[model samples]
Each structure stands twice: as structure tokens, then as C-alpha cells.
Target chain A: MERKSIAIDMDEVLADTIKALIEEVNARTDLGIKEALLDGNKIRHFMPEHEGVLDEVLREPGFFKNLEVIQDAQEVVEKLSEHYDIYIATAAMDVPTSFHEKYEWLRTHFPFLDSQQFVFCGRKNIVKADYLIDDNPRQLERFTGKSLMYTAAHNIHNEDFERVNNWKEVEKYFLGNEEI
Target chain B: MERKSIAIDMDEVLADTIKALIEEVNARTDLGIKEALLDGNKIRHFMPEHEGVLDEVLREPGFFKNLEVIQDAQEVVEKLSEHYDIYIATAAMDVPTSFHEKYEWLRTHFPFLDSQQFVFCGRKNIVKADYLIDDNPRQLERFTGKSLMYTAAHNIHNEDFERVNNWKEVEKYFLGNEEI
Candidate 1:
């Protein structure tokens, strides 16, 4: 089958953004919690319960600079590239100084994320993509094609998007094989 | 002056979202320049340079859980309410669970924020407001009535929404110093 193009949102889907956010906050605040005690399932939206913990991290001199890539994002993206033209689309707006760092992170994580394929856009609605993988509920309306919503711990209100609980389901849906 | 309605976005204008985000990332990995050293002047979009830092911070848990509020947001919002109806129009989809805390934060910061006139919405573009104060670039197009762009470090793109930068300008353009 000829490869079709797919636009993927970077924050939560390709990157374990929420997880990283939580860790940084904990580290900054010097909070103590077992690693297993926190997971994707725990943090949803901006929970007040987590505010004290987060504030501790933010108070540190430079807490928001370092973030980690989602596990297996590179492998998943590479495999998907074999069957689809991939475009990285993020709503993270203009902060020109950070563009290179953001782009390089994508390349490092996805390995195949090249300049040609990546697009930092303000409006996801304007982009033309056959498929989109996103964690945002709003992005679902923007897609006319198959839009896969990566399942997250706190995506309760975003159940409207077609849910793919894990990489295996994503593989099955896009590649026609579920045993990922 | 008769009080009318108002809506606002939180990150840049109300709080130091970008600064905090940058700080959080740098602290975790020691990747790029320390958060304080970053000169965000020419940058339009958050790119690869910052991505390296972002990748590091994201590895930590609970980063986003601790986003800080804008400095003068409470005071400004209170003062604005003295002359207009105040509503919070945020693009943040995670407001439901976090609304109370956010609202309480606002109240703690400014008592006037509690007076029965605020709305927490996921889709600000679709919502109706007599006046809108936001930092997001695309939101300028979505607003119908008097739209004001809150000026801040990360919101340099908001220069595009120059018609209304502060309440003084908003009054000059929208209210016209005339009693409603």
C-alpha cells in the first residue's frame, strides 16, 4: 500500500510530557514519592492535589527546561514512517529561541523526524493530514480522517476521540496488526 | 463606567508560564543555558534549542501539575472587575478538575474574582465574550468584541494583536470612556 501522511501532536503522544512534568515538579520541590506511586493514570488536567508538589519544582531556578521523550516513541514513529508519511505538528506556538532545541529533541527521540516532516503550527485545524495522533480533545474535531487518541491516565473528558490505549492498538489500527 | 464582561488567558499575561517552563527544564538536566540566562528576545517559536531542555525536564514526573499563576493577574483582574464583568477564557482543556484551585488561587490573589462572573472553558474560540484578554496568537482571530492581548515574555507573538495591549488601550478602543 502506498504510504499516506500522518500528522502527530508531540506533547503527550510522542512524548511522555505529563510524566516528565510531574518528575521535574517533584525534583524541584524536593518532594518524596515512590516512582511507582505516580503514573500516566494519576495526573489528569491540573489537579489541585498536585499543585503543592508542582510549585516546589517551579520555585527552583530553572525547572521547566528539561523534559524527556515518551518511551518507544522513536520505534513507533519509525515503524509508522514505513507505512505513512509523518509530519510533526505541535500547537506550542512561537518561542523562536526554543525551536532548534524542540526540533532536535524530536529528531533524537523519533530518529526519523527531519526538518521537512516537522511543522510547528499555531493552528492544528488548518493542517492537512490523513491521520492524526493526539492527546488533546480539541484536536479531534480538526481531523476529517482517522484521528487516533493515545490513551492517557487523565483523558477522561477526551473520550470522544477514537481511543488507542497503547502502542499495540495503534499498530493494529494503522498497520492492520494488533500484536505490537 | 458601567461594568461589562471580561475574559483572560493565564500563562504569559497573567503568569510567567514560558519562563517557568524554561526554568523547570534547565534545572532537571543542566542541558542548555540556565533558565535565567535564556534571552527570549528574537525567538518566535519554541524550537530545538529548547527541546533539548524540554526533553530532560519531561523525564521528571509532575511538571505541568505545578504551573504558576501570573504575577499581577489577581490584582489586574480585581481592578478590571470594578469596571467590567470578569470571566476566564483559557485554552487549557484541563480546567474542570483544576478550576476550583485556579479559581481559589485567583480569589486568594484578588478577592474580586469571586463575584459571580467567570467561565472556565476548554474552547475559547467557540465561547462568546464581550471582551477577551489572551496571550495565544490564534485567539485574536477568534474574539468578537473588544480583544486585548496581555503582554508578557513568552507572548512576543502577541505583538500581532497590538490593537489592545493593556487596559488603558482597551479602554481607548473598546469602551471609549463612554458609559455603557
Candidate 2:
């Protein structure tokens, strides 16, 4: 039998990038924007005047390396790996420095997923898998497989794909007694 | 009907990396090693005394961007794209700088293959495809799909998989009237 596969996004889905960015912005700049104010994919989108803040923060050496892992992402992905081929596909091309840092982050946090299970690319459409779990609907738009939108502050308004607010919801959606 | 896919390697298979490395080495250093002497995957393997030469040349900007296209690679890959999903999967994580350079190289040379068709990754095992065409037998060792060895100077002696000397042979093997 063919083993099923799942392509997972790293940024907002597995790693709390927005949360880290918000914390950095609040601490570094005069802008006191809270988490609730961040309602778009990019932190810059919410604050057009402070657009450079996002780029400045991301350009830091350890910005991507120090991101906190999303709640329940490690456990849920570990469980999913038992039955499916789990691949971590991240759009790391935009920031060239993040390539090795992201690779090290995955190795340090999720040791179960070896170098072979990671994909660092520009776009998600190049990926071929049975399912994709991502925060951005734009990434899932052209996916030929089942697209599951992991809820995020920016994507809360988008209602195009099946929604999973958290990792527990992901488990219930895929491994639930009900048919998938 | 499900469309068949083929994952192709970029370095020695589609791009003449070894040739470029040799040219750069001879032009910059006193080492006069020819292409025939390059028996291993890395240029450093052949020149153990001048081991740093490989790293030094690769670190130069546009090293990957300025590589020559392999003979008939563009035409053959274009032909293959008509019937199969052609993905250019390169093991580019070793050099972080090569990520964007390789991406732009593909965009400049093979315009037919969009960003969706390119995969900049570390290991080929993570890739999901019907077939994989690569020069390194080590990359093809654990692949579940049909593996075709593309002939290269370093991998010529390795006979673990079925070999194709050039793109013409690949065309004959895949879409020719005669059996592969």
C-alpha cells in the first residue's frame, strides 16, 4: 500500500512567527500595537507607516532561529508521522539567511523529522502531497491535495478552505472517528 | 487520470557544475587537474591537498548563477514537461547563498518551469514523485520510485541503477519506440 503524505508549513502553522514579531515590535519600537491589532499576513500590512519595522526585525540574525514553537504542533506532528509521510515545507527563499537557520531550528526542535523530511523553497505549489496544513490560503490556493487552513490572526477572515484553529483540531479533523 | 511526475537533479545533471569548478580552479589556482581526474561528487575529493579551493570558488558570488547549461537539458526537460510533471529538485542547503541564485538561474534559463515547478531542498528522499533522475546513486539509494542514473564524470563507475549517458538516451528510455 502507498503511504500517505502531509506537507506542513513552518512559519505561522508550526512556529509562532507573528507572536514573536509582535513582541519584538512592542519592545523595540514606540509602536504599542498588541496582538489583536495584527490582522493581516504580514505585520507590516497592519501598520503601513511602520512597514520597515517588520523588515528590520526579520533581518536580525536569530529572528527565525529563536521563534517559539506553536502550541501542540510538536506532539501532533509526531503522532501524524506514525501514519503519514510528514514533510516541513517552508517558504524561506524571500530571506536567504533564514535557509540554514530554519533548517537548524527544525533539527533542534523536531528531531523526529530529519534533514530528508524538510523542504526549503520559494512557493508551496511545487510540493506534491496528500494534504497541506498552512496558515495562508494563498499558499493553498493552487494545491491539488486537501488544503487545511490552520487558523491565524491574519487568516481568520478568510473562509476558503477547511479550518483547524489548533493542532488538536487538526488531530480531530484527520484522525477523528468521522470520515475524513 | 493521474499525471506522472519526474524529479530531476540540477547540479551535475542539468547544469555543468564540475566543468565550471575546473575552469575556475585552473584560472585562479596552480592546480591543473582536468575533468577526467574528477572521480568523486565534490571537487575537493579529487584535490585533497587543495581542499579549500572548492569552498573558496563556491563562496564567490554568482558561482551557481553563472554555470553553463548541460547539453540538450533545456530541450529534453521541455519535451518531458509536456507528458509529465517536471520538478527541478536541487540539494542546495549546503550553500545558503546558492538558494536564491539557483532560483534565479532556473527562472532565467528554463522559463517554462515556473516557481511552482522548482524545489530547493536538502535531501531527495523527501520528494514525492513517480520517478527521479539524478547523477548521485546515493541520492537514489532510498527512493521508492523508479530511479534513473544520469551519467556524470563522478558517478560514471557507479552502476547501481539504470544509466542514461545524455538527454537523448533519457528521451529514448522514456518516450522512445524501443524498450528502455
Per-residue lDDT of candidate 2, residues B1-180 (tens digit): 868989899998999998999999888778787888666455676677877778889888999999999998898888889889888889876776677688888888899986767787766766767889999888888666889999888887787999989988988877782644
Best by DockQ: 2
Q: Candidate 1, which segments miss by more than 4 Å at Cα?
A: A30-66, A94-97, A178-180, B1-180
TM-score of chain A of each: 0.75, 0.93
What lDDT score goes with residue A13 in model 1?
Answer: 78
Residue B32 shift from truth in candidate 2, angstroms: 1.9
Q: What C-alpha RMSD separates each model from the true structure?
A: 13.5, 5.5
- Candidate 2 per-residue lDDT over residues A1-180, each given as its tens digit: 878889999999999998898998888778887777666555676667777778888889999999999998998899889888899998876776677678889988899986767788656756778899998888899666899999888888898999998998888776772433
Candidate 1 C-alpha lDDT tens digits along B1-180: 645666676656665556656667546544544433333342224445565555445334444345575554554455566677666555433322333344445445555554233333333443345667776656766565566666554454444665455545545454465532
Q: What is the lDDT of candidate 2?
A: 0.83
Cα deviation of A71, candidate 2, in Å: 4.7
Per-residue CA lDDT of candidate 1, range A1-180, in tens? Answer: 756878888777776656666666556554554434444344423455566664454344332235566666676778888878787776543232334445556656666655556654444543456788887666667555677888765564465777887766777788787465
Report i-RMS for every model.
Answer: 15.0, 3.3
